[model samples]
Target chain A: MYVAVKGGERAIDNAHAWLAEDRRGDTTVAELSVPQIREQLALAVNRVMAEGSLYDPDLAALAIKQARGDLIEAVFLIRAYRTTLPRFGTSIPVDTARMRVDRRISATFKDLPGGQILGPTFDYTHRLLDFKLAAEGAPLAPTPQAAPDMAPVPHVTALLDRDELIEATPDTGEAPPDLTRQPLELPANRALRLQALARADEGFILSLAYSTQRGYGRTHAFVGELRIGAVAVELEIPELGFAITIGEMTLTECETVNQFKGSRTEPPQFTRGYGLVLGQCERKSIAMSLVDRALRWKELGEDFTGAPAQDEEFVLSHADNVQATGFLEHIKLPHYVDFQAELELVRRLRAEALAQTQPSPRAAAE
Target chain B: MSIMDRQNWMGLLARARPADLAALLPDLPQSQWLRPPEVGAVMVQGRTGGSGAPFHLGEITVTRCSLQLTCGTVGHAHVQGRDRDHAHRAALVDALMQTGAAADLQARILAPLARIETDARAARAGRAQATKVDFFTLVRGEDA
Candidate 1:
């Protein structure tokens, strides 16, 4: 007879202790500092903040270090930390128009007012590995010039707006419903859906956005403009009588001009899909905008083709990696008790089938 | 004055030098703890192009303190990052501002911070403007 296994608690404790040792991994070289992660591995930190939905660089850095550079795990850490926080108040919407832009580019316009300020981008770099980087002191060719004098750049979409060629966005001061406060329901409003997509896993959103390009819910989109920069945040305090700038944060904004089919009620005009994310997350922002446009098919009077991107419920529900990973990885836990019952039933059924196939012993002897 | 203006001045007061507020209200107010000074996080939300639908950007660490003064004025302060003392000071200033003493507080504390914030913003903008570029195209003779 097999007895139920015990002492799992002690084994689990020992395993965790061993995991801590393994995580350090030959500590002779040097230990990673939070500042090093924050400054050096900044892109990772940005992704963690974007998906984790937490903006603090220091905490994101620490989470990255704790998770051993696993971005999804780092995001999970941030999400767990955020759940414990007390919300004091909501800030006034940040003004991106007043953003001190670092990198601004438009696909539609060649000669924009501000011109193209390609701030630190890898768009033109060759992908070959440099052996010199493995050694000390790699030299780089430098380009020098007098700093260009330019004016404040206007958004490319605004040019379209001048001719009334784009969809109108009205300024309604209605407070958007909070996604965190209530359970998610199907057919989520635009605000709630956007909230879900902003923190959605980048890879998942990217794939869905990619599917749209491959004729799944196809909508031809042109990048109207994409900008990355810092914007000041202001908050309203009733006692003070006016809004005040509290701080500044870096953000990535993407606007997509999509070709929309017009109905009898409206003339054919270019529609827009927008994305705004924390830090310089250009890829996520672009993917988010594409998906954002795909989700708006119903509102724009476009027929739903039953595409993955068009299914808001499916996309929002599965976009969170933490929830997905938990459900997926939970199957590894013990299921022996359930299996044992199935084992007995199968054995009995096999024996019965064997008896049915052959005659009884007395009948066979006769 | 309007709540928006009052909030603006209070934000300045909260972020300004603690010494300035300490000098004005040296003694801490005799108030009961409505919500004790605690460090927490708030999920920051952002809107597309500053005017469209809202989305969750991320959460930031914030220290919040709330208290009720003996005279029935309630004050609250929520500041980014974990600074308990700053939150406490801000909360005290908030409660006092609600009372008739707001005018004194604004003139003494808010003015300096407002100037500091404005100057800092202008300096940043100046540095960014130095790198701005303008592009022009040359005319070609064959275009007839």
Candidate 2:
């Protein structure tokens, strides 16, 4: 009698203990503290916070450490922890207009209200690797800039709106659809688009944005404004009958203006693309804005040409790295039982074909 | 002082994460309502009659609570067969029935199942370590 091997539980336990040991490494070696990770590896932490959609850099850092420096795994960890958390209430939508702008820039207009603040960017850096920095990178000297004490920078979109050139973004007060609760349908709103871009896989969104530039679904985009800074997250307490500032997050907001050739009915308005993220990730924001525009084909009176870029359902559905990685890696699980059934079916089919070519004694009698 | 670093990535998974599925654009059935089960059960592996080796040969009873929210959100709190905190979970679900809280709960409750599964496996491994044996016997010269 053939017996199935059954030690799944034991095998799992042993593997976990081993993993714990591996995570810690040698017992004699000093343990890495969470603070060390948070401060030293701030950028990694920022990416996790951005992608994980949770603003806690400390948690993100801890997650990164526990994940063995695997960002995707860290994102997964954050996602799981976030589920069990006891949420009191929803906060009001953050106003990027009133954001205490640290870094603000516009590619569309150089001499706009907010001239340009490059903030911290690697755009113009040489591509060559610095081997000296491999040992210990020198501390970057902070660039000092005179504060624009007069007032915060006005939005680049505001400039277009000033002239009635671009379409106005209405705050209809209608709550945006929560993509988490509802399954994504074909036609999505601007809110869903923004959310998708915010939590989208950085690389996937980048590639999608790159595709637009390569004429896949060319939408000439000029970065209207990109701003990064901390914004208060105010939550309403029904008991208190007031909103309280619970926390704050550093966010990156990108608004893009595309060339619009109006259709028969609508005016020739400058189409808009918007992207907002958890941290200072300009590329993610720019890409997000482009994808956001690409997704607006239905709203824009544009034809659905069956192109991959134009397919909102396909793009949004496969936009997450966590979901992508999970599903992609889940294939590695044991499928021997299923394989055995398939093997039996194929054998039966081959046997039947062979019998038909040269009838066996039993078959001939039948 | 929350931070994100490469190390933080792994740490994040050390717990659990389900919100990542937002990328998949999962079609979750809309139902904010919750109903604590009058008589519920979970498929928990019952220990073997003895402690020789805890195999997956048997299963035990685990009663759970279920509550249905007004928005049709179903909240289930399964404990070690019976738990009082099911009400807490139900209340959480009721709260989640609100406009935006549903997203939080889906990530907090459902996504951590994988990590819990991993932890359970680890526990079993800890137990198996004791019973791990290397068997051998001295042979008599008579055979030679």
Candidate 3:
């Protein structure tokens, strides 16, 4: 007997029940509070905020909790919700130069105008596990810092330009490309490059950066400066006819100094790769610089080697994790109808092929 | 194939909402489609026979707007009775579902809209049936 399988209401209900049970886990351990997740797992929240493109910490935290600590899933949740809410209006471009510094450092200079302040970084820590954390409660030392409000951070790049060694950074306030609105076309402006870097995958960005360092498409990068801080996002109310501080966003900015390998006719003008993104994502910024350089191969008079990292269309399109996951997982949906059609066609083709190659039983009598 | 019932239709409609929905408005999706918006006809109740004899439906006029997103999402939005937001929201849901918010969307937006639509439809049917009544009269005897 031929039997056809169809998943009805009962199957769906049971599956959902199983899934909920799986999500909850064994009842022995205490369930994590949303606040606790937000406060403690802050970097995760930051990443979610950056990629989710919404600046709400509480909502991101809630999404993280609902996603069971899957940061990507949390980001997806925020993004989905963010799009649905009517876009009232876009805020004015944030000024990174005026950012209230939290963790600021300059790699190009040992001693600059603004001293390097390593606020809170896991860079120097050993990978050894702490047994105390496993046993539940543990005492932690209070954070140390008088680090009050200070003067504006005169960028490390400015220090280099004081001698007139590089080209002056142009202040073109022209509206940069919105990648969300339009398709990513070749020969992108600086705006498009930065946007791609902001949402790019951590590991993938890191690898492309590593490749550049290894001379696959090297751009001789010395992190001219890396700064992480908070900048106020200002919105101009049409009724009031004046701009006001609506909210602030935590951001990481990176500017890399590359050797001015100029063309035959052109002057030896030094260029820089710059990136700015929501939250403290120095790694992403730096990787962004390398990728940024790779994408600007044509502009920089570098040869097109057809690298995946160098491919503008490929990188910009696939940089989004949410898009990548959805298309990949869509295959899980039932394809039985299509599969059956293919099966019948293939069977018929094979039968015809066999018939052509072999003699029929009645052929000898004929 | 199975019988078309209220429960089956409702189940299909409810899938529009997720169990844990988000609070986002879906934007119009884009596509790489070649076709531009052309004048299309909308289905309307038309009496081929009289209303008493049970007639069929006819077609009305509608305009559809479609565009392809950078992501190659061929979004189609048609105003039923000319409601642009309706088509736009449908296309937006189609785009966002491809993203991470599929679950939240189902719970919040889709579920609520489905519920509202179902309720409104039921209300309309009730109002229509209120006026429906059967009447009869007996003939007078002429012998008197």
Candidate 4:
């Protein structure tokens, strides 16, 4: 049992003041602004927004600044701030089919409709440090091209669907579980699992996905489609009796086709794993898809080979960094009473063991 | 000017930058709040497998308000972010759009905002188009 003792009020206050001072380090230098972080360190802001499960970039940037560049802390700050606000309503599901395509590519097809457009990607860049960037040199502006016709890019998996080569994504028309409002229950549906993976810690999900690639839970996954773009979010107004676009957000979507043989009642077909996340987060979305596929082993009738990724309970329970960090960091708090009790018990047990092992005083004297 | 549907105009208004919308609105009209500008979040949902069942993706901050002009035109606005003034201005525009000022507002406000948005989108699309891969077959002596 933990007991609360309150004597460090002044110390805590002083520490917080010192933390504020340290957070604004080097008074001679100009402090970093939230807008600069939002624009320049965009990927960092994206990660915080995705994991925090909040879509406000300004708030995310402010959290990053207040957290002094610690991303998980920033995410925690956002999550805490999010709970204080009232939920107006839920938006109609965003239509990714109508997304304004920015970067879209497929490994399965060399050339497909809406040819692979590498939008602001660092894929071909060498890992060597650019000293010019470090020296604050402004590079030449990007060369502009004639704008292409705004045609909707069809999914590569849809082509496979035309031939009935891959399993069709079922339109269940079910309302998905809200993981935020309700406690996570085991044996989650595909929608619930996807929602969890979308906001799951990037590093944690990445490692899990990496393990699957390393033969832990091999799925032989292929990147069928990876697209990043902006999509409009719509909400229905009861008074107006129509849905209206409230805002638009950038989303990175990944669909992976995995090899699956026929089951007793099923036929051999390529299965798919999906990942959708807020902002231009390609790596996280890819990682999420791989892990999502691995976790579906049971539903897919594949042997549960006891891989860490296949354990739904284990994966979902520990996937949240906020929960993990809270428990891990709480150990630093005062455990004096518990420690003292353990110390006394340990002393008594050690004394008893020594007394038993050694000769008694009377026996030794005799 | 082509008249826009209620949905289209509302979306354009919501997506417009606060400063841009404010710059366009130089005149004030007498109005009362039916529902004052309030900041809150709306849980955004996404489909499973991109076309499957709907799932809660996350929450986004949105400010919504409803107001009525002295002429009794009621209007509502829901915009992304925590800008109370933006929401108020959008609501006012919604009210004004129903009156005799619809054509004028369309010319002075909505048209320019829509043009700005279109130009921005075209510029982004142009940059992306430049990166489109163009594949060509390499001719060989064996083929020749």
Q: For all the predictions, what are the DockQ values?
A: 0.29, 0.01, 0.01, 0.72
User: Which parts of model 2 are misplaced by more than 4 Å?
Assistant: A1-5, A25-31, A136-150, A263-267, A358-366, B1-144
Query: lDDT: which is higher, 1 or 2?
Result: 1
Best by lDDT: 4
Alpha-carbon RMSD to native, per candidate: 5.0, 22.6, 27.3, 1.8
Per model, kept true contacts as a fraction are 0.38, 0.00, 0.00, 0.76
Q: Rate the local accuracy (lDDT) of all candidates.
A: 0.77, 0.60, 0.60, 0.90
What's the TM-score of every candidate structure? 0.81, 0.67, 0.67, 0.97
Docking quality of model 4: it rates as medium
Cα lDDT of model 4 overall?
A: 0.90
**What is candidate 2's lDDT per residue for A134-176, written digit by digit as tens?**
7655786654434233255577787788787888775555555
The digit string of per-residue lDDT tens for model 1 on A1-366 reads 666877589889999998787778788957889989999888899999888887778889999988988888899898898888877567777777767777787887778777666656666779888777888566667534334343456778778877878886665655666767887888887778878888889999999989998989888888888888877666554553555554567888899999966778878899888888888899988899899999999888898999999999889999998888878887898878878989999999999999999889999999
Off by over 4 Å in 3: A1-7, A146-149, A183-187, A263-266, A362-366, B1-144
Report lDDT (Cα) of residue A167, candidate 1: 83
Structural RMSD, model 1: 5.0
Candidate numbers, best DockQ first, in rank order = 4, 1, 2, 3
Off by over 4 Å in 1: A1-6, A130-153, A172-174, A238-243, A348-366, B1-36, B48-50, B55-57, B66-77, B85-144
**Lowest lDDT 10-residue stretch of candidate 4 chain B:** B1-10
Model 1's CAPRI class?
A: acceptable
The predicted structure with the larger lDDT, 1 or 4, is: 4
Ranking by TM-score: 4, 1, 3, 2
lDDT of 4 at A273: 84
Clashing pairs in 4: none
